[model samples]
Target: MTGSAGGRRARRLAIGTAVMLVLAGTNGPWLYRFGTERYHEYKINRPGYKAVNGHWDVVEFPKEYRQDTIHAVLLHTGKVLLVAGSGNNQDNFDAKRFDSRIWDPVKGTVKKVPTPADLFCTGHTQLADGDILIAGGTKRYERLKGDVKKAGGVMILYNENPDKPMTLPEGTRFTGKGNGKVFLSDDSVLIPRATKVFDRKTGRFLRNNPGYARVVVEAPKEGTRYETGTQDGYRIGGLTGADARNTYGIANKLGMDKRDFEGIRDAYEFDPVAERYIKVDPMNEARWYPTLTTLSDGRVLGVSGLDDIGQLVPGRNEVFDPATKTWTYTRHKRQFPTYPALFLLQNGKLFYSGSNAGYGPDDVGRDPGIWDVATNRFTRLAGLRDPDRMETSGTVLLPPAQDERFLVVGGGGVGESRLSTNRTRLIDLKAAEPRFVDGPRLAKGTRYPQISVLPDDSVLVSGGSEDYRGRGDSDIHQARIYDPASNSFRRVADPLVGRDYHAGSILLPDGRVMFFGSNPLFADKADSRPGVFEQRIEIYTPPYLYRDSRPSLSDGPRTIARGGTGTFTARRASAVRKVRLVRPSATTHVTDVDQRSVALDFTTSRDRITVTVPANRNLVPSGWYMVFAVDGRGTPSTARWVKVP
Candidate 1:
């Protein structure tokens, strides 16, 4: 009887095992994917793996505190200032719903600050007094050709009266002499007084060169019939006598074509401590995508942007005086594409990397060169590969400002083109003839790569799209550390989020890097759905931070003047082998002209470390900086804020 029972049980077990194998075969792919994902998570989270490749964590603010951040600046207070004016949202712009946020990364707190204007696509830089100088913004969003209903174009308003300027208010009508088409000014314009030109050789007057202003004018009603193709003189309405004769307008075309974004002249100074924006004198020119670079003398230089008339500024640059809180035009004229990567050289000249965000003629101002702002002379640099693919590229002043080396990262073709390059270029300004040479290549062609100078003297290059605006789901998730000492790139852990257009990274005070903003053109590989702006901020803790422990830095002087010394207490002072004075970053569109890691001469004692700041004003600009003490193992302590007054 026992033998019969054992045979029956064995038969039942065989039947069950066969049924289970059949079910597993039916769901093989799903089971494999689930197991693979679980294994990845477990591997990345492992302590051993983290110690080698670091890790990434996402910071998602509450729904009410979320914003479409377009620009981020690391303030002196260790809080990040996030600005998202209208946030590339046309609906928000129409409703005047601008946004700015102050986030404390350590405390995980967020606060909203009232934004005064549409600071979208504006330029910002760190000031001498720890304030952030913000200038330019969007005045009008772009309207595509098919979406444009009004017949509108640029109108050159002429003021022939040398005695006085003319101001034309919005809604001012202009009737063309030939076509008799009535077009109205979309915004108010101020035309300067006519310049009375005189012959240089003789005392006799040559003629009155009429002072003109370009304004966008549109037909009163929307239709293709109101479009005009030819140039015509226009009669000004509500003007009589001399006003009528002196204030006429001339326009070459007024057709229902695409209209690009217009810019505003609004400017402000953001006070980090007070957590408010102080209104300052507006810029001389309305700018949509400008760059604010710090001059050697401490004044702020504003350059390269789309003007109020939706055209390039025509090389008319300006300067901002912090003491006077005013802007004055520079004597020289030099044009560039919007947000050109201009860095200040130790010799007090400016270097243009030919890296720009967008907007300008392909042939004009596309060459990388050294610019003499004083004389308006540009000396072009040779050996730049893929020069035609410079738009959206990133330029970084390599670690140790004393070296005067720069690296230009990957970029894409001009305007919405699918072309991209994986080449990296390096230049040494200290050389007799500084020219670009090929460096390490990226795994894929990239654009909008975020480059940050780490405290350990290595640069972190991460995040970019292989196509324009990450179209076709081409956002690269890779990160690399470029060692200037080795002149090579080492691949690190991949980022969790995909960053492309409008994205940037900033080195935080805690020795980690923070990334913000990603404006992709499409969401899927097939480009079927419109892409959404990435609002979650991602923090990357480098491998150096995953070690056993970091050196502790404390009790440092709040201010250190140029060519001065400051002593700070560090328990692991003997292990501290390097000291770096890193300037805070103000980044947008992968352009960060403010950040540079300056090496400091240091001596370590039993329990204290003394560091000396460089005497060169151009090398170490007057501002607040993060003083980091790196141990022998390349572990950096939490930064101690120091002011270079």
Candidate 2:
């Protein structure tokens, strides 16, 4: 009886031990399946579903934007605002075709709105509250008006009786006020008396005596103001509309008329959800061809650009205050050229990498350096191989936002040359005595490449061409991915359309990139000739989309406290290895002034995840960001918007 009982106990123990081992062996898979039920419910990993990698998909819009979309900004409401002011020509402005529209990619809806002013070639920045602050635009355009008669000897109105003998008979009178000359035609002697005679010596006019007036003299001075002479001639009380020359081309090749195309002092905020623009206080100084950069204090810095008079507004950098909805100028140390590539450093300094959209003179203001806004000082750096090629080049702040490193790639030659270069350079601003070091070269030389920072911290460089206006068959259809960790660039899929000149790109919320807008020379006009404005948009999905199962944030607070810890639940927390918050983008001319990716410290327990938010406003800034959960394989989940309050 004792032997039987012992054998039964041993059998029971063996069964219990075997059951424990099985449970232990299958624990990981079971927990993963339990946590990732939401991921599967979405049918993201369903059978027979082919997920493409690093592919470009062209999307059709229900409502096509008839006007060219030269400027684009991604709003926190998950809508993109596109603006093309005047469509690059005077005819479009006259036709009131300058437009602004909001595109909801998820619903495939587009809402067109009226643009108050010509915002073509404007500078834009995203405010902390997700409002867009746009500055500057083409107040006027440099256009060729119809030909005028080439008459410029000057003229003076004469009041003479019909019976009086003509002193200056059908000839030029070389003697007049201030030794000026006047041409007398056959009808000059049969003119009426002058009410006022302008004196060239004193630069003033004398009232004619009615009783003493009989035969009036024809002279260069003393005449009604007209458009027949130079612009100054009308201002000095001369023959206003007689045989005078207006502004004209300086006998250059093409013989195009030259006029001052000034920049507007306008500023405004665009509401993405409402698809409307609210006029804000105008900028203190007018800016055309400006660059808007977001600073650490949540104020937007407006730098560079031509003033109202078509002159460079140098040194005086303007800052937009959201609270006051006004702009304050910061007397900067050095004058930056128009659209200078300005990136805010982690240490509160501005780095001018010399990458600029060509607007000002080529000989001035392409020096790379760190500028101190408070002190108005610049710490210049050396070692750029081709500093002269900084015009229209593409520059980006590399991913892992904490790293104070930037890459400058591909630029055209100075001025109107349009020659592109494949040269690349990098600089680590945090390093002591930082200097630009050689980086990987591009497969094809391009100008105005749109370098978008991807969810996985990789940069997707797309668009651009080897020459201006994409001329000479220089449009590069291929796209490339830049890996910061590898310090290398590799070819990816190609986009359908060619983008250059006024083209732009923005990153969307769903881990996809939206590429839109391209204005070449004449834009969409009949006179645009061989040029075509790109109205269609293309969305690019990175290779990470086709990877293994992705994590999903099932629960989290919409508002996150800056420098505080927040708890959230991810359906696939087991696969999530890291957390990240990427700022929304406001992009134009390959200039994404506010795009940034910040890493978060996180810990996971089953389906629960807690993340530490960055405390420094300089690091994360008070604004809206797309919070993403990245898996071990570098695949990122569709982000959720989290506002840092």
In order, candidate lDDTs are 0.94, 0.73
**Model 1 clashing-pair count:** 0
Q: Pick the candidate with the highest TM-score.
A: 1
TM-score of each: 0.97, 0.76
Clashing pairs in 1: none
TM-score between candidate 1 and the true structure = 0.97
Candidate 1, residue 543: Cα displacement in angstroms equals 0.5
| Tens-digit lDDT string for candidate 1 (138-212) | 999999999999998999989999999999999999999999999999998899999999988887998999999
Q: Model 1 residue 81 lDDT?
A: 100
RMSD values, in order shown: 1.8, 17.3
The candidate scoring highest on lDDT is: 1
Q: Write the per-residue lDDT of candidate 2 for residues 250-343, one digit (tens) a residue.
A: 1001111233456888999987666688999999777888999878787889888876545677667789999998998886545777888888
CA lDDT for candidate 2: 0.73
Backbone clashes for every candidate come to: 0, 11
